[model samples]
Target chain A: MNAIEINNLVKIYKTGTRAVKGVNLTVAKGDFFALLGANGAGKTTIISILIGLVNKTSGSVKIFNYDIDRQFDQAKRIMGVVPQEFNFHMFEKVQDIVATQAGFYGIDRVTALTNSEEVLKKVGLWEKRSSIARTLSGGLKRRLMIARALVHKPEILILDEPTAGVDVQLRFGMWDYLRELNAGGVTILLTTHYLEEVQQMCRHAAILKEGEIVRLDSVKNLNKLIQQETYVITVRNMQPLDGIQSYAPVVIDEHTLEVNLNRDEQLNDLLIKLIQNGFAVTDVHPKEHRLERLFLSLL
Target chain B: MNSQWIAFQTLVRKEVARILRIWTQTLLPPLVTQTLYFIIFGKFIGSQVGPIHGISYMSFLVPGLVMMAVINSAYSNVVSSFFGAKFQRNIEEMLVAPMHEWVIVAGYICTGIMRGIVVGILVFLVSCFFTHPAIDHIGIVIMFIILTAAVFSLAGLINGIFAKNFDEVAMFQNFILVPLIYLGGIFYSILKLPVFWQNVSKLNPLLYMVNGFRFGFFGFCDVSVIFSAGLLIFLTLVLWQVNIWLLKNGIGIKN
Candidate 1:
């Protein structure tokens, strides 16, 4: 069964702002899907509508074969959301937030407490369970949100900008946990500004623009859409190199050069030429990530 | 337990915890204020003005003061709690939950009424050190207490739903609610007022609440107990319906 299906989803605000415009989307069961878009591109609106936080002007949404509006209880029962903002009570204790969320899903007190502890431990927050939520650092707070979202054991998890302000180490740690969760057959619908996150974790992706779905495909297939890729090369010499000017390299500095390569180009040939010309290459890497290139192209 | 039951219980538990957790703010102020009212108005001033209905002045004022504390606590508890939830945007948690609107309203009302009753009981206990006023009608007293709390709790919910900011909330309490309560016959009987002023005081619903509760205490009231109880019931039903409608429409929380 599909985890989520949205058709003709439209949300027009009171001021006539068309936040979402007849967007159709589907996430298969157990699929790790990414919804990518710029700010105000209707990413949050779509998630909000699905979760009943916002009323749709016209549309249909179903989760696990349950209609969102008609069978709201059933649909909402199997879904958990990590909103873009920290919506939990800040004055509340960490464990209470997670346990209360489980209780909201109808779990008994004993089961909710067990689930809360398990999820908190998994998120590395068990040691701080008694501490108030507002005292946690930004990275820990993000993990707390993840724990709260997962405490109920929903079949589908929606994470909207879950790691926005998190540092690199903590961000990657969360990525590992999410990967493990997805591998355990949990469907995850993620929306984030981190292109690297989508590139690493999402198998399928949909990019939205101006309240409309602009691109939807597997990550690998989307990467194939990029006809050219740019690479930044660093040389040992601090002076300009000789020869190989036909490739139209832009000198970033005395020792660095930026080169654009078509999909068919051989990087080894260019490296051999640089070596033959007595320019010792130190490093070479893509200027932009593959998903980032695609995302920018679609935008 | 069922999901609906669990959801309702959890909401109520959270609401109660929030109220009790801030005891200095929610529970203490009412007790202190009521104690002062008993000392200053019921004792010092009442000793000078004497009593009406052939009872001591301090004994006559206890029920009205207790009811005032109940109404204030019930109204403020729901307003501050719910509005705080909205201001912090944490109300979205319940909004996204798979619970009925009535469950949410009931959870809030239960907490508000709990605060009201707790404050009323504390205030009455404090009043005991000054005056030994016996209950004349325990049933009517309990009835009026619950009815008044329910009415004000629902009204507070409505005020919270429409309030956009802290100042707006304060405006409802300061300009509308406080004035109505003070003028609701807390200090003196409406019979002492002139004919026109007495009729004007009757227009305030709080007057009926105070008089009904006073009747419960002394069997003396300016208005009929039946009329006061009927008015309280009618307002409770109307405000409850209005709150349910506001929640169904997603007034201030949804855009």
Candidate 2:
């Protein structure tokens, strides 16, 4: 069964702002899926609704086959969330905070304490167990968020910008841990501003623009967001390479030239031109579609 | 079955510990403030001002001072803790959890009550150094204090829900709380007011709490103790429901 199914979801704020406009999505159980969007793109709003924090104006949300709006408590049972904001009791000790969250999920203090210890150690917070939450560094706080989200052993996990303020090295480490979690059969949904994160981690993806789902498909399908292709070529000799007219080669310098491709375009035309021009071609390379181009397209 | 209960207990304990950690700010400040009232209006001024209702003015003012401290601290605890949650944005964890929303609210109110009662006890201890105000019924005074704390804590929950920013919270405490407190028969009995003003003062909810608390001390009050307890219970229930709705609907929070 799909971990989360959002069908024609519509959300209108009480102030009359229509934030989400009929978004439909189905995230398969255990798949690492990325919800991509720009600011004000309704990504966070959508996540909030699924977690039961925001009420939907209309439509349905089903988590693990249970409609969240109709069966809130049961749907919430299987879901865990890591919010983008660092929202926790700052003055409280880390040990108390994590254990309290476990207790909410019905874990006893004894078990909660043991589990909290293991988890805090997992996030490198065991040494600072008694430290106030506010005194933790930004990176440590992010790790703390991860530990809290996982305290209940939820079947489905949602991370909202989990690596936003983290250092470059820690970001990679977090992604690695999440990858391990995903491999362990927990369905994971992530909303991120970093495109490369999506490229590396997600198997399926969606894009939202101005509160509308502009794209939704497998990771490979998202590559289609960029249509035109680019190819770069290097030659053994530099000569009058202008004859490569059919492939539209632009001679960038003495050794390098570039060509843009369409579906019907053939590379033979450029090879024939370069051979005829006495420019011995040594290498021909095609540049794959990049997220930067896709982002620019969405904008 | 007991999971959520444990969660609730932990939340309450954490909240209580937070206030206890800052005992000076949370407990001592009210005592100091109330002592000023004892020195100025109770002893220094009571000597010049004749007896009030056949009792020393100092004895009469003690109940009012105690109730006021209870009301203010009770309301302040909830408003500040919840608003601090709103400010630091930590409340999101509880909101998104699998736990019930009512549990979160109850835990918060419990924290408020603890602060209110702690300060009340401190004020009582401080008052001992002044006039030895006789307690006609210890049970009745404790009951009145609990009811007063409950009602005002619920009111503070409402304020926390509706307050949009820190400035708005300050505005509520300053404009609404301070005026209502002064006009609630704290320093003077409503009996001294003109008939029209006396009738109006009776309608002020704080009047019942203060008068009932006074009944606990001197066994004399403007109204029946039963009536005061009843009024406080009614206010507590009404404000409790309103607070629940405000929190459930995210009135000013999510917006």
Candidate 3:
């Protein structure tokens, strides 16, 4: 069953801004799906409409076969959302925030508190449960939101930039937790600016541009659309670039070179040529994420 | 046991917790203010004024002061709390939940009424320190208090829905609510007013509330008890419907 299905969705604000225009998309159950877009690309708008936060101008949205317009209560029962902004009460305690969210989903107090404890422990926030939300750091607050969203054990989790503004270490930690949830059969729909995250964790992605989906495919297939990749190579010995010029190698310093390799070009062939030319390669890595390159190219 | 019932209970629990958690802000001020009213209005001022309807002025002032506390507490609780939720964007929590719109409205309204009754009881106790007012009709007193609180609670929800900012929230209380309460015969009998002004005072819905509550205490009222109670019930239903309509349309809370 599809976790979410949106058809010909349109949203025009009262100011007459057409935020989302005739967008159709679906996220299959148990799929780790990424919705990629730049600012104002209607990513949040689409999510907002699905959650019934914002009224849709036209079209239909269904969650797990429950229509959002006619069966919102049923649809909302199986979906959890981590909004783009922090919306929980700042004055509330961490535990209260999560348990209170469960209550809104019609969970009893005892069960809600039990679920809150489990989710808080999973998110590493059990110790901070008694603290006021505003006292927590940004990363902990993000984790608290994740815990709140998961307290109801919804089948689908929708997160908007869940890792944005988090430190690299914490970002990786959240990714691991999300991966565990996805592996446990939770359908995850995420919107993020971190292209590296999408490349690492998302199986399929859809890139939205100007209120429309411009690309939708598996992550591996999307990576294939990149015609070229730039790599920063660190060498122990400087090479006189004579034979590797076809790769358009640019010398960054005495021991470092930047090179662009076409999709058909082999990095092994280029490295061998460099080795033959007296360059002892110490390290080679892409200067930018492959998905980021494709994403930028699409825009 | 039902999910919607559970949701409603949770909302009420959260609201009650908030009211108690901030008792210094929500519950204390009314107690202090009504104590001052009993001292100044009933004791000091009533000493100079003659009795109305053969009852001491201080005794007559008791019910009005208690009703005033109920009205203000009920109205302010929902307005400040709901608008605060909107301003902080935390209202989205319930907006995205599986509960019906009427559930949201009832949750807020129920809590508003709770605060009103709590504050009303406290003020009545404080009034006891000043004078022993008779409860002529206990049923009428309970009915009037609950119905009055419900009416204002609904009105407060409407105000909260339309309020765009904190200033707008205070604007309704100060400009509209305060004026209506003052003109509702809290201190003076509308019977003392000229025939024309008495008719104008009758138009103020709060006048009926105050008079109906006062009738419960002394068994005397400037307006017919039936008319006052009927007006209170009518206003409650009308305001309740208005609030439900606002929530259904997502007016002011959603875009």
Candidate 4:
């Protein structure tokens, strides 16, 4: 069964604005799905509709085969949502937030407490469990949200911009934990502006533009649409390669040389040319992320 | 069903804890204000006004003051707390959860009722320092107190659901609730009013609640116990249904 399924979903604001216009999408069970969109592209409206925070104008939404309109409680029981905004009581203690969320799922106090501790420890917030949420930093708050979402042991985790303001270290740590959760058979649906994270984490992706899915495919298939890959080669020392126009290399500062090569171009040929030109290459890496190129192309 | 109970308890606990944590704002102000009313209205002013209905002026004022505190606390508790949740957007957490709409409304109203009763007890205790209020019908007093709290709490929930700002909440308390309570005959019996004013006082729903509560304390009221009890019950049922409808429709919570 699909973890989530939306058929012709539409949302029209009272102000006569059509936020979402008949969007149809699906995420399979145990799959890591990415819903990519720019700001005001109706991503949040979709999430809100599924979670009962926003009323849908038209369409059907089913979670784990339960209709959202008719079986909301059953649908919600198996799903956890991390909304884009921080929607927690700021004055509440860290431990209380997670446990209260578990209680909302009808979990008993003993189980809620146990789950809270487990999730807090996993998020590296056990030491600050008794502290008020307002005292935590932004990254810690994001982690707290993740911990709360996980406390109920939901089968489907829907994260909307989960790491929007998190630092690089915390972002990677969260990514690792999410990957571990997915590996453990949790279906994950994520929306994020960072295309690199989508490339690394999601197997299937759908790109929404102006309330419509303009592109949908596997990450590998999306990457196949890229006609060329840009490579940034780091040289051993600072050197001026101003006359190297044949490769159209952009000499960035002293040690970096960026070159764009088509799909048919050979890496060895570029390396041999650089060697013959008396330039020492220390390392070479793709400059543009695979998902980033595909994302731009679709937009 | 068990889960629904658990969720309800959690919401109630959170609401009560928040109010208790800010006791100076929630508990202290009402107690202090009621004490002043006891001193100024019952002691100093009552000495000049003398007795009405064959009871001391101080005793006549106790039940009304207690009910006044009950009304204020119950109304403010729900309005501020619910609006605080909306302003902070924390209400979305409950909205996105699996709990029933009735559970959410009941949890908030339960908190309001709890605060109302607590404040009523405190005000009554303050009144005790000045006068011994006769308990003509303890059961009637308890019933009216609970019903008054429920009615105002439901009204507050409706106001909170519609309020878009803190100013709107204050407007509800000031422009609507305060005038209704004052004109409800908390200070003087409606019998003291001129004929036309007496009829006008009857239009204020709060008059029935206060008179019903006074009947419980002194066994005397401008209105019959049956009329007061009937009106209170009818209003409670209507307000409850209105609150439930608001929650289901997501009037002020959802876009």
Which candidate comes out best when scored by DockQ? 3
Rank candidates, TM-score, best first: 3, 4, 1, 2
lDDT of 3 by residue, A1-299 (tens): 89989999999999999989899998999999999989999999998888878899899999999998899999998889998789899999999999999999999999999999999999999999999999999999999989999999999999999998999999999999999999999999999999999999999999999999999999999999989899999999786777888787899998889999999999999888988888889999999999998899888
Better of 2 and 4 by TM-score: 4
The DockQ-derived docking category for candidate 1 is medium
lDDT of 4 by residue, A1-299 (tens): 89999999999999988989999998999999999988888888888898899999999999999999899999999888898878899999999999999988888889999999999999999999999999999999999999999999999998999999999999999999999999999999999999999998999999998888999899889888888999999988755555456779987878898999988888889988888777899999999797888788777
**Largest TM-score belongs to which candidate?**
3
Which residue runs does candidate 3 get wrong by more than 4 Å?
none
lDDT of 3 at B209: 91
Superposed Cα deviation of residue A31, candidate 1 (Å) = 1.3
Of 3 and 4, the candidate ranking higher by TM-score:
3
**Native contacts recovered, each model:** 0.74, 0.60, 0.88, 0.83
Candidate 1 regions with alpha-carbon error over 4 angstroms: A238-243
Q: List the residue pairs that clash in candidate 4.
A: none
Q: For residues A8-114, could you state the per-residue lDDT of candidate 2 as single tens digits?
A: 99999878888999999999999999999898899999999998678888899999999876687778768889999988888888988898788777777788899
| Candidate 1 lDDT over residue span B1-255, tens digit each | 678889889998998889879999999999999999988998788889866889888988899899999999999999998999998888888887788888888888888989999999999999999989899999999999999999999989998999999998889899999999999998898899899999999899999999999999988799999999999999989998888999988888787
lDDT of 1 by residue, A1-299 (tens): 89999999999999999989999999999999999999999999999988888888998999998998789988888888899888889999999999888888888899999999999999999999999999999888899989988888889999999989889999999999999999999999999999999999999999999999999999989998888989999998854455777678889988899988888888898888778778889999999998898888888
lDDT of 4 by residue, B60-80 (tens): 899889999999999999999
TM-score of chain B of each: 0.98, 0.95, 0.98, 0.98
Residue-pair clashes per candidate, as listed? 0, 2, 0, 0
